[model samples]
Target: MTTAIAGRIEIVSDAICPWCWIGKAHLDGALELLAAEGLAFGLGWLPFQLNPDMPEGGVDRRAYRTEKFGSWERSQQMDAQVADAGRVAGVEFRHDRMARTPNTVEAHRLIRLAGVDGVQHATMDRVFRAYFNEGQDIGDRAVLGALGREAGMAAPTLEAFAAGDAARAEVVAESRALAQAGINGVPSVLLDRHLLFSGAMPAERMADGIRRAVAILRDRAA
Candidate 1:
C-alpha cells in the first residue's frame, strides 16, 4: 500500500494562546509519528493576534484574565485545564509564573523576520517559552532581542527591527484578514488554503486530517 502525500499545512496561531501551544505539541507528535511511518508533509506558521490593540508595555496577566474572563476563579479553572493538557503533550506550562501578556505585534514581526532566515519556527518556540514558561514580557525589546538571539538572529538586527515600526502594519492587516475570514480564535489549521480545522485536535485526528487533505490534493492533480 502506498502512503498518501499532501501539500503543506498552514497553521494560524498566536503565541499567547495556551491551546495553540498544545495544538503545536500535538502536531509535532503527529509529524513524528508520520515520519516514523515514512510519511512526509510540510508545515508553515502564520500570524494571529488575540489582542491586536494591546499596549506595548502590556497588562498584568491577572488583571487581563479578570477583565477578559470575568473572575480569577474562572480564569484559574481554565488555566488548570490547559496546564493538565499541556503536561500530557509534554509541555511544562508555568502559568502562575507569567506576569503580563503584551501586545504581540512585535512578536509577530519577529516571526516574519524569522521566515526570512528560515528560523520562524525556532523563534516562535522561544517566544512561547519565554512568555508562558519564563514569565518574560514579550513586548519588551530586550526580551525579544534575547529570544531572537536564541533563534540564531543577530542581536543588533533584532534590536533595530524591534525598536522600529517595521511589520506593524502587515501584522494588523493579517489580523484583519483573519477576522474577515471568520477566524475568531487561534490554532486554526488550514490545509491547501481551503480546508479549515479550528481548535486543538489530537495527534491521530490531525494526522487523519492530513491524510484526507493529501487525498484531496492527489485527486485534484489527477
Candidate 2:
C-alpha cells in the first residue's frame, strides 16, 4: 500500500514579483526540511498578475517603477531592500540588469500550460529566473515560448499554445477572481486550497505552518 501524502502546496504568485520568487525559495527550503520529517506533498503554481492593467508589450522598468512608486530614488530603495532580503534567502536579484517591467499575463498563461504538461514548477522557476535574474522580456511570446521549451515542453506545442488564446482568458479571470477574494498580494501560499499565509516568510515559519496544516489534515482523516 502507498503512504498518504501530507497535502498539496499551492503558491499563487506573479512571474515578475521578486518577493514571490523569494517566497518560493523559502518554501523550497521548507519542503526539504519537511522531507526529513517524512512528510510529502504535491506542489503547484498558480497565476496572479502584479500589473494586471499593464499595457501589452510592457514598458521601461525604471520609468514604470519610478512612476508607480513616486520616484526613481524610491524605486531603487525598494529594489535595494528586496536585494538584501534575497541575499539572505540565497537568491541573487539583479535589478540593474532589468530593463523592461513586463506585463506578466502571457507568462502566467505559459505557467498554466506547464501545469498541463506536468512541468509547472520547473517552468515557473525558469520564468522567475529569466525575469528577475537575467532580465529577459518574458512579456514577449517568443521569449516565453523559448523558456517553455527549455523547461521540457515541446517547441511546436508550447509555441502554438503561446500564439493562441487557450489559457489567456482563464488566466486573466482566475487572477481577477483571486483579487476579488481579498488576496490583494502575490506569494500567497495555500495548503489544501485554504490560505496558509501571505507574503515572503522565513523557511522555519513556513515549515511550522505546514506542520500545523498537515496535523489538521491528519486529524480530519482520522
Candidate 2 Cα lDDT to native: 0.89
TM-score of 1: 0.91
Instruction: TM-score each candidate.
Output: 0.91, 0.95
Per-residue lDDT tens digits for candidate 1, residues 1-222, read 344445677789897998888888898888777766667666667889888788878899899899899999999999999999988887888988898888888788887777766777778888888887888888887778788888887655686676787777887898789888888877988876765588888898888777677677779889
Residue 87 miss distance in model 1 (angstroms): 0.6
Candidate number of the best lDDT? 2
Tens-digit lDDT track of model 2 for 112-161: 88887788889999999999899899999889898999998766669667
- The models' CA-based lDDT, in order, is 0.81, 0.89
Q: lDDT, candidate 2, residue 133? A: 90
TM-score of 2: 0.95
Q: How well does candidate 1 score on lDDT at residue 117?
A: 66
